[model samples]
Target: MADTQTMPVALVTGAGRGIGRSVASRLSAAGYRVALTARSVEDLAGTAAECPGETLVLPGDITDPAFVDQLYADIEAAWGAVSVLVANAGAGVSASVVRTTDEEWQRMLDLNLTAPFRCLRRALPAMVERRHGRVVVIASVAAKIGEPYISAYTASKHGVLGLVRSAAAEVATKGVTVNAVCPGYVDTPMTDATVRGIVEKTGRSEQEARSALASKQPIGRLITRDEVADAVLLCVTNGAITGQGINVDGGAVPS
Candidate 1:
């Protein structure tokens, strides 16, 4: 319902909930007109309520090429150019390498890797042409390190780093900075569902599985959504930094 097209515009995929919602809220509070896009309109509505400025609720399956095209077109038509793009829409599947089906692997890549690619493809041209833009991908710590049972998720997150580095290199000189925020275990509905899966599969108590997941981080707790959002805020707001994956993992994958 926001009609302010002249304000600086931001497009946040997966902006309905979780870290995406936090990013959108932060950006809106910082005076950008935010576009919230996710699969659920109702979820987007919740995020929209938190934004301080004008908000456009754009709901769709970002993995579809057609939807990506229209999303960019609509944003451009409405707001002139997309100033910030937070490619935060992704999903993870838990499976060992040998037990993982081709369908599972492909699904992970389609959403985590290729969907961002499509968004970037549509978003970058305007940024490149204008000589000003920010691209932030919500990657995972699985990108930098490996895990035992989630081969598909790990590989896809790794692929995200490749995309981030290559694109950042190409656009670094153009005033369009590209980077990623890699989180270890964030407290979100997604993580809750993951906890449920662990309980179901391993027959461990819910509390034990949750503890085990949090134990990966030296801080003995899951990362907060706002913690991840802070890194993204820097990536999009600061012009100098580029081609990096800032880990918000509480020393989980330290050097």
Candidate 2:
């Protein structure tokens, strides 16, 4: 159990669904007051309802700078200070480099790369002043291993890792640690959409399509949302883990 007296407040972006929702729920259960942010108010509310500690629902797009500023302000006013910031808002686009449009590429960078950087920039001042903080960015396996039809996503995640490494170095001596968790093919809404795409493209049943995708991993199954959440929890709770992109990929990439 987290110590209630020192129980820190956590702000998680993209907390409406998938790994984000799992992370928020786990943290709240561990006695952290959690602030949940996402674009869908209903989904955010549902996530908040599952949490044990005080939950603040702030629905907005993390890619929007103005909205992100407002989110921080709201959290600050209510929570007094943010001890953990989870940059978990990101999306994937299916397109090869040639087929990917400028808009698609920009959108991927905005969400997966720029959004995390912006949040870190805004959160760092307060964290530094307090001489303590934890920042965890939910990156992807594609960051290290390039995947076909996900060039934008791969590039964006790679950029995210770069940001993590740089930030970790900058704040290492200041009582803050920055790290990333790279998850492969988790059973989430994003994976559902990918399964649907495979079905549409190959005339396969949904189950078959999902199976094919899962088979790509050595474990022959998709990682669960809770599994990914466990990894994020490790990064946030462990003080010595910094500047590391811990892979939760079911041995998809042998290290």
Candidate 3:
């Protein structure tokens, strides 16, 4: 539980846009000093400008271990310790196993799995010492179900859930909670690209392509970025959400 007198600091990766941006903004509104990290300096700066409290833009490739170490070092030097870490920097690369190259497979695993692991490892020691921390990994619905042409993306997300579950169990008694949020078809740049891919394949209008994807979900439309952000906020602020993967997929996934 957070003390009312001491405002917590949150480090959000991929905070440039979409759900990550919304989560970072929401945390700031809730009185957390935010440290925004992304590969794009301009986009991170834009997000920082919208935040309510002190915001630091730390732009670097999260997949690079050296860059990750430097990121934590900078945070430790400036803020002493971070109270929250949102591992939201991930991407989807679609290709069947037979067509997937080793580079593609490794890239997905590096960004989606290993990067989060690195961030968690760096933050755990400080959080354990303080007896307070919230670690949220933003995974995807593909983790639970089979998605065609996206084997690497699915595998990486599944690995994310495994990491969250194992780490949460280890840190539960130490006042740190680790959790994963799985969102489906959120209206983001990622979805836009997916829609474009559909359009190219079917020669359909963008709206039609988007609709085709959205119709697969039980809900009639794609989930909004803010909706996903809300789920992350719940995980970060609640003490009892450890070792869980809360799905915000508009009921796309069955319980």
Candidate 4:
């Protein structure tokens, strides 16, 4: 674990909004000096303003390997080292397996799976050398269960889980722990997009579309962004917790 006395540096991808923004806020409140990253620096401003401690707003596309390298370089230059990494940036698409195009598959995989891989690849060496680090991947319930019309998203999320588990095993004895938080039907801009899609496709009211997603969970309501961030904080603070996919789906996949 990182030193509790000194403020740790937390790098959060997609810190622009939603769960990522919530995670950044939570970590900042917990005494972390957060480094926020997204496409445009302006996207991270809201999160940065909410942070209690220091913040670095980095703008870049993680799918580009060069950007991934440069992101770490800038963080290292500014904060020296990052003690925690929240791989939260992702993209989603709704399309049946037969209708999913190759471009869609690649885009989803590149941002959702490969980008996290790139971040971890850069992060592990420093963490391993220091013998202290926390890793949390913001995956989804889709990783554990299959849903129609989102084969690419499901596959990418599944890969995220695999990456978390395998990376945790590799660093198990090295003092770094990796874990994943799987959220179900989160109430966010992304959920709104899903709702809009449902409304367009099925001619359902927005409320009906929302309820359709909520009904999948046993709790019959959408999970909040902060709820998922809380789960990530559990892994971040507890050394005993590692290689686990903590679900915030209200029993939606029950994994």
- TM-scores, in order shown? 0.97, 0.96, 0.96, 0.97
lDDT assessment of candidate 3: 0.91
Instruction: Report every candidate's CA lDDT.
Output: 0.92, 0.91, 0.91, 0.93
Which residue pairs show collisions in model 3?
Answer: none
How much does candidate 3 score in TM-score? 0.96
Could you give candidate 2's per-residue lDDT for residues 7-26 as a string of tens digits?
Answer: 68899999999999999999
Output the number of the lDDT-best candidate: 4
Itemize residue pairs with steric clashes in candidate 2: none
Give the number of colliding residue pairs in candidate 2. Answer: 0
**Sliding window of 10 residues with minimal summed lDDT for model 2:** 1-10
lDDT of 4 at 93: 97
Candidate 3 C-alpha lDDT tens digits along 1-255: 555347678999999998889999999999898999999999998899888777888999999999999998897777768899999998888777999999999999999999999999999999999999999999988778887899999999999999999999999999999999999899999899988888887799999999988987788899999999999999987999899888889898964
Tens-place lDDT digits, model 1, residues 1-255: 545655678999999899999999999998898988999999999999999888888799998999999988887777778989999998889988899999999999999999999898888998999899999999999999997989999999999988999999999999999998999999988899899999999999999999998998899999999999999999988999899988999998873
lDDT of 2: 0.91
Off by over 4 Å in 4: 1-5
- In candidate 2, position 143 carries an lDDT of 77
